[model samples]
Target: MRDRIDEEITFRKLEVLLAFMETGNLSKAAEALNVSTVSVHRALHSLEQGVRCALFRHEGRNLKSTEAAQMLADVAQEVLTTMSDGIRATREAAGYSSDRLKIGSLYSLTIRAVPGIVIDIKVRRPTLQVELALGSNAELLDKLKRGAIDAALMALPDADPEIESIPLFEDDIFFAAPAGSPYANQEAVDLCDCRDETFVSLGEGFVTYRGFLEAFRVAGFTPNVTMRVGDIFSLMNLVSGGVGYTLLPGRVRGVFGDQVQFIPLKPQFLMRQTIGVSFLRARERDPNLLALMAVCRLRTRSVI
Candidate 1:
């Protein structure tokens, strides 16, 4: 017989504690749990009163775990994992398996690389239906954390303990100019040449934008930004129309379809961004994930 749940140990309390542990901030934890922040606060308060001990110490919006709280969190994770596997097992025993796989990626990648990989996977696993979600890097990561997506193909995110990332491809950054652009025929051009050019760029808060800024710093010049827009296709379109030149990833040629010409910078400026597969560490062991990883590994190796 299974042991009874503790009178005070409600699933709600465990969920509150686990969410806090997963995300360092209360608001984000509430977001992950799909509950109001106030509800989470009340649940923790009630839990503390019932347990007769302080489980969390507040630091601004963050809840730092006490030793006891950490202990409970470890067990809570075990409980959650057990519950998840139990459900999966029950489904499998019923002769039911998920028919569709959810995949995600950034806009730039969805146009070419991700589709190619998806098509290849479909040919190999005809029983699987692939669903694609496209978004910015941050949005996709949030979806993965909340179990909204199985995995994504994207640039490496900021350091995240919960995310398990693997390298797939290394793309170099290049300078893209319109045909007959001033620096077009030049064997190589100085970074400063772009200093005065009206720069069309991706909006702030993109990994690519951050990398682009760093590349400029390395090239020893600050670009004159005349416009900022979202999506690489639009940026490429603007560049093609002679609005301004922008830094282009080596793979941009594959997506932009010969609409733009790539010029090698004099010093050959290249910022290597790995386009890899990423998923929550917690789901890393799912059988579907394992199969997907095998497909990605096989495809990525062939390309490299």
Candidate 2:
């Protein structure tokens, strides 16, 4: 019984019929659906065979829709509409936000990456509103875990069973100094050699702070004490104003223009931040998140 029903009618055929009815011709329907004219003709023919009736009749050189075809087109439109609405409602019940996507991000990313990503997402979903929540990496992660936001853009955290990540890009930690500093002329800075130099840092909750601590741990000594700031932009400005040197991700290199010099770190003291989107493991199938993941992947490819 199931096989007989499946053979007699199919969703794909309904879509083709609706396209044909709306477009008024084989080639036009094919163009609307992004399929070949031959495929459209074949689908309509197969649809007529399945229904065991005449859907189109010859008139001069054109095929005009018969009464059965017109009737089927009306039913097809209703069925497809109900099915689409049902699917969307089902997804919304399962945690998909159909109207707005709330995104959390590190404040640093807003300077270079977030603007382009937001613009592209808008182009893809014209009616969907995007809200950006900026905070430290830890803060963003907490919001994401609590459902305060739909997804987060920040450094990848340690592997967890409840969280999923899509890595967009990797950024190297650079030693940033005021433009007139002695280190400005050097190609690279050694973290171990700078054990006595004063340095600025994002607060402990920031991802870059984790990198800062880890690099020093690898260097076998703690960095000299200076003031710490709550945001990356302030910390960068502190470095630019000659308050103290700081380690920063390469992504922010363009933020300060020529005021700050970004130098690479020697190999043993090197660290890189893998920045990406993070979301709930169970909600990976949410339509909004899936679209965001697709956008992230596509944008990453273009950047590469």
RMSD (Cα, Å) for all candidates, in order, is 17.4, 8.4
Clash numbers, per candidate: 0, 0
Per-residue lDDT of candidate 1, residues 1-304 (tens digit) = 9876547777778888888878877798889989999988888777777667898887875667788888878888899889878887775443233666788888878656787788777777789888899877777888887777889888878778989988888887778888778777877667865666787788875667877798789878888888888788888889989999888777777455556888766665667778888987767766666767887788677663
- Cα TM-score per model: 0.65, 0.69
Cα lDDT tens digits for candidate 2, 1-304: 4546538578888999999888789899999999999999889999988988899998897778988999999999999999988988787667787889999989888886788888888888889899999999889889988889999999998898989999999889999899989898778888878877898888888989998989889988988758999998899889999989989989888788999889999888788889999999889988778888989999788652
Report the number of the highest-lDDT candidate: 2
Which residue ranges in model 1 land beyond 4 Å of their true spot?
1-97, 254-258
Candidate 1: how many backbone clashes? 0
Winner by TM-score? 2
lDDT by candidate, in order shown: 0.78, 0.88
lDDT of 2: 0.88
